[model samples]
Target: MRGPLVVLLCCMVALGACRREAPQTGPVDPSGDGQVTISGDDLVIADLNWTPPPVRIEEGAEGDARARAAEALGDDDLHATPASAIPLYLALSAISGEERAAAAGLRRARIRLLALGTMALDEADTGDSIAGLRAAHEFAAVARFLAADDPDVLTYLQRVDESDRLWELNRAAERALDAGELGEDGGGALAGFRQAAALRPGQPRAMQGLAAVESALIRRAEVAGSEGDFQTAARWLAHAAEVRPGMQTVVDARQRIQRMRATRIQRLRDEGVAALPKINGVAQARQRLAEILTIAEPGDPVARDLRQRIDRAVHYGDFRPGQVFTDALEGGARGPQMVVLPHGGFMMGALPGDADAEDNERPRHAVRFERGFAMGVREITVGEFRRFVETTGYQSRAVRRGFSMAYDERTGNFLRRSNVDWRSDYAGAPAADTLPVLHVSARDAQAYADWLSAQSGRRYRLPSEAEFEYAFRNGTSERYPWGEGTPPQGSGNMTGALDRSPSGRRWGNAFAGYGDGHWGPAPVGSFRPNPWGVHDLEGNVSEWMGDCWHATYRRAPADGSAWINPGCRDQVIRGGSWASSPAQTRASWRALAQVDTTNARIGFRVVRDL
Candidate 1:
C-alpha cells in the first residue's frame, strides 16, 4: 500500500511541477495550508485485488447473513481509494438470491461512490474531477442502485454543495483585501470573512481570510490610535471583533481605550473640580463636562461625580440638593443642620382639586427660584434657639413683654401666660433641647436669623410665604404634603382624631385613622420628613414667614421674595401644628399674627441664600 501511494504521489507531484502556474494579482492566502487541492488522478490512485465472497444462500437470521457478507468484504481502509471494492460489490449484487445480499452490495457501492466523488473534487484539476465522478455515477446506476436517502450519504452531498458557496465567500473576502477594501467604504472583507467563518467552522480558506482581515483591522486601529483619534481607533477594533470575536489584539485594544478614557476622565474631573472655587469656575467646569461626556461610557462614575459637583455648585457651599449640612459658627461651632433645596420653580398657592382653598391662596401662579437656597432641616430646635439667645445676650420680644400665649392641656385651649418665652414648651413647661422652639414672636425670630447671619457669614433669614410653601411641597402639587387621602401613620405630629391629650381628650376634627402618638408638639426630627429630606416642615408647628400680612396674592412678587410692607404690624404664618385641625393641615393654609404676638403653636425655620 505504501509503495503504490508513494509512487502515485511522486507521479502527481511531477505532473503538477510540469504545469504552468497562472499569475495572480490578488493577495495570496497568508496560510500555505488554505485552498488545499489534492494533485492526483485515477491512474495515480492505488487498489488491490480482492478474493470474492462464496455463494451463501443461507435461509437463516438476517444478522447472520449480513455478518457473512461483511466477513467476505473484509477490512475497508478509509484512507485508500474505494476503486477495487466496486468490482466485488457488483459481482456480489449480481449473484444475490436474498434481500440481505442485495442490500449489502448496495451499501458498499454507495460508500465507494461517495468516496470517489469527494476525492475527485479534492484535486484542483477539473478534468480529473469530471472523469472520476462520471465513472463512480455510471457504475452505481448501471451495476447497482445506491441508497441515496441514507443520512450519511445525504449529509456528505449537502456538505459538498455548501463547500462551493463557502469557497466563493472566502475568495471574495481575499479579493476584497487585495483591492484595499478593508472596510474603508469600498467594503465587504470583514462582513464576507465573518459570514464565511460562521457558516463553516474550521474551513481553512475562511479561517485564513478572517485572520488576514483581523490583522488589517488591528493595523488600521493602531494607525488611528497613533494619530490620537482614539474614538476612531476603537471603532476599528470593534469591527475586528465582529470578524473574529475575542481576538487578543482587539481585546487588548479595547482595554487600552477604557484606560485612556479613565485617565482622561480623571484629569478632566480634577480640572473641573479645581475650577469650581474660581470666580468663573462653573463656566469652566461646564466645558470639561462636555468633553468627558463624549468619551465616557454611560453611567461612568467619574462623569456622574463631575455632574453632581456641578449641580452642587448652585447650592450653598459644597452641599448638594437634598443634602443636609451645618455651617460653622465664629468659634468653630456648627449652626443648624441645613438642607439644600435645588434651584427650581413650583406653583405657590392652592392645588386644583382643593375645595378648601382660601381666597388668599387663589391664583396659583408659578414661582421660580433663580438660585438655590438652604433651609434649616427642622424648625429651630429648643437647644439651637437657646444658643442664639445665649450668644447675643438677646432679649426676645416675648421675654421683654414677660408674657406669651401658652397651651393649657387641661382645657385644650391657648391662653396668655407670664414668663412664657422662647424657653417655654407648649404648656409653658421647661422645653427639651430636641423640642422645636415656640412662643417666640415674629420680631424675635428675625433677631435670631440676623444673629445667625452675622455669626456664620451666611445670609440667614425667614423664608418668604412662597418659599415656605414651595419647600414643604417638595415638588408636589398635592394639597397635603403626604398626598391625598388619610395621612400614613407617623407622617408627622399633625393632629389626629385617634390621639388623646394628657387629659385623654381627642380633637373634634383631625386626620382620621392616623395617630402620630402626640397630642401636642413632638420633638423635632421625631416624625418622618417630607420628600425633600427636611424635617418638620409641617405638623411640628405652624411657622412664621418673612412676608407681612396680605389679603390676597393679587400683587405678589413672582420671584418668591417676601412681600414686605415696611413697618407693617402683622406677619404671615404658614404650615400646620400638632394641635391643628384637619382643615388647617392643608398645604396652602395660612394665617396672620401681630409681629409682637408670640404663640405656643407657631415657630420659625431659617433659610440661607446660596
Candidate 2:
C-alpha cells in the first residue's frame, strides 16, 4: 500500500509540474476561428519605476499625446494654466521618472509649461519693461534660468504654438498693478519704477528726489538765517538762486547781493579811504550801475544819476595832456648842425653845505635852461661822419700809430704800452660814417668842431662847462635829468649804484656809475636817452668842455657860461662818463684828460646858438 501511495503522489507532482511548464490556450476569435496561444515571450513586464507601468501606444497614440502636450505648452503663462494640467505634468514626470522611453513625453510637457510661465512673467514688464520688446527680454531671461542645465530645453521653449494668450493675462495684471487697482505686493513692482527712473532721468520721480535734496539745503539756509548766520545763509541762498526756477528766488538773491554791497560801502566809508582795503570803488560802483540798469526804467532819475556818477569817476584824477617831442628832420637823422633835445632838467651842482661837495662846486648854484637848442642830434652818424672823412680825407688821431693809456686788470692800474688802434680795437665795426669816431682826443673834438663849422658855414665848437650844464639841466633843479633822486633802471645806461666800489679796481671808478657797467663807449644813444635827448651824458664817454678844471670857485663866474683857467691847457670833462659813478655824473661833476690824449669814450657834442 505504501509503494502504491508514493507512486500516486509522484504522479500528482508530475502533473502539477506539467501544468506549470506547458503553454496555455484560450478561446479562439469567433470571426477568424483561430485558436489563441501564448508565445514563448508572452506577457513580458517592462522595467519601469511606476505602477501600472507604461504600455506601448497603438500606432498614433504618441503623436496625439505630443500634439496635446505642445498645445498645452503654447500658453504664455503655464503658471496661469488650468490647475488641472499641473497634476497631469507632475504625474507624467513621476511615471516616466526612470524610463528612457517615457522621458520624451515627460520632458516635452515640462518644457512647454516652463516656457509658458516665462512668457507670463515677461509680459508683465517686470521692470517697466517696454510693452512688446521688454516682454521678450524677460521671457528669454526666465527661460534661460529654467533650462540652465538642459542643453535641448531652449529649443522646446522657443516654440510658439498658440496665440500666446497667456501673455495678455500677465499684461492685464501688470497694468492693474501699475494703476494701483491691484493689491499685489509692490516690492517686485518697485523695480520697474527704479528702472524707469534710470532710463529717463529728471522724470517726475527723479525730479522729486532732486527737489528733496534741494529743499533740504534751502531749509538749512533758512535755519541759518534765523539763527543770525546771515553770511552763511547768504551763501546758501546764492547757490539756490543759481538753480532755483522761480523769479521770486532770483529777485530775493539780488536784493541780498545789493544789501551786501551797501554794507561793504558803509564799512569802507567808516574806515576812510586810506584805512580801507584798496578796493576799486569806481569799478564796484560801475558794476552796481550795470546791475541797476537791467531793472531800471529808461527815463528813471536813479538811472540817470548812476550814469553821471560813472562818467565822473572815469574822468577823476586822470592826467592832463602833456607834450612829447620828436626830431623834425625826416628819418630822425642828425642834421649837420641841428639838435633836438627831449625836455627835462637837472641840478647844476651840490647843495651849499653838502658834506662831499667838490672844491669846484664850492659856490653851489642853481641853473636852468628852457629852450631846447639845436645840437648834433646823434654822434655824427657813420654815414654822415664817413662823408666828412671822405671829403676832407682827415686822418683821425686814433688812426695815428701810438700806445694809449688803457686799464689793465692784471696790474690793477693803467698800462701805457699797448698799441691799440681804432681799426683793431673796434674790429668788424660798421663803417665810420654812422660810428662816432672814437679814439679822438680833446684836440680831435675841437678839430672836428672847426671842420664842421667851416663845412656848414656856422659856428660849431665844444660847449662850455656852464652851457653844457645848462643844456643838460633843461629846466629844473633836480639832481638828475629825470628827477631829484637817483635815476631808475632804464632811465639811462649807467653802472648801477649798487655795483660801485671804492677799490678803484672795478670796471670804471665808483665815480663812473651811469653807463650800465661798460668800461668803453657803447654805440651812441645805446643807453636810455636823457630827458633833454642827450646821449652818453651820464656814461658812455666824458665830454671835452672848453673850461679847465678849477680847484675852487674863488674865481668862478656866476654867469651861465664857462670859466676857463687863464693858463690851463688840459680840457675839462664836465659830465662823467660810463667809467664814473652816480655821484660823478652830477651836472657840476668835473674831470680832466690831457688835451692831446685820444681814446674811445672821449667823443664830444657841440653847442650852437639857436
Candidate 1, residue 600: lDDT: 88
After aligning candidate 1 to the native by TM-score, how far in Å is the CA of 436 from where it should be?
2.1
lDDT of 2 by residue, 1-610 (tens): 2332222222221223322222222222233211233333222121112122133333434444444444544432222222222223333444433244335544554465444434433322222212222223333333454344565545533432111222233333233333433221233222332333454443343233223323433444555544545566666655555433563744654465445545544433333322212467566666656555544436645556555544433432111112222222233333353444322344456655555458766566543333334555445444555555556777666556565555444564545544543332222233344455555667667776776666655557777776677655656565566654556655554555444233444544342233254444456666655555566565556678877777665656555456765767777776665555667767667777778776545567776533
lDDT of each: 0.71, 0.47
Least accurate 10 contiguous residues by lDDT in model 2: 44-53
Instruction: State the weakest 10-residue window (summed lDDT) of model 1.
Output: 40-49
Query: Candidate 2 at 13: error in angstroms?
Result: 99
CA lDDT for candidate 2:
0.47
Q: Across residues 1-610, which tens digit of lDDT does each residue of candidate 1 receive? A: 4332223332222333432322111233444111223222222121212233234333444445445445444433211222234334443455435455656565774575455445533421222232332233332232223445677666655555454555556556666775657763435776776677687766555566666777777667766655546688788877777776766857876777667667778898999999998999998998898878977778989989988898788554576677778889998889898888888899888877788888888787888887788888888988999998888899988888899899887677899899998888999999998889998889889998998899989889998988888888888878887788789887888888788888898888888788888867889989777778887766889999999999888879988899999999999999899888777888788899998888889999999887
On TM-score, the leading prediction is 1
- How many residue pairs clash (N, CA or C atoms closer than 3 angstroms) in each of the candidate models, in the order given? 0, 33
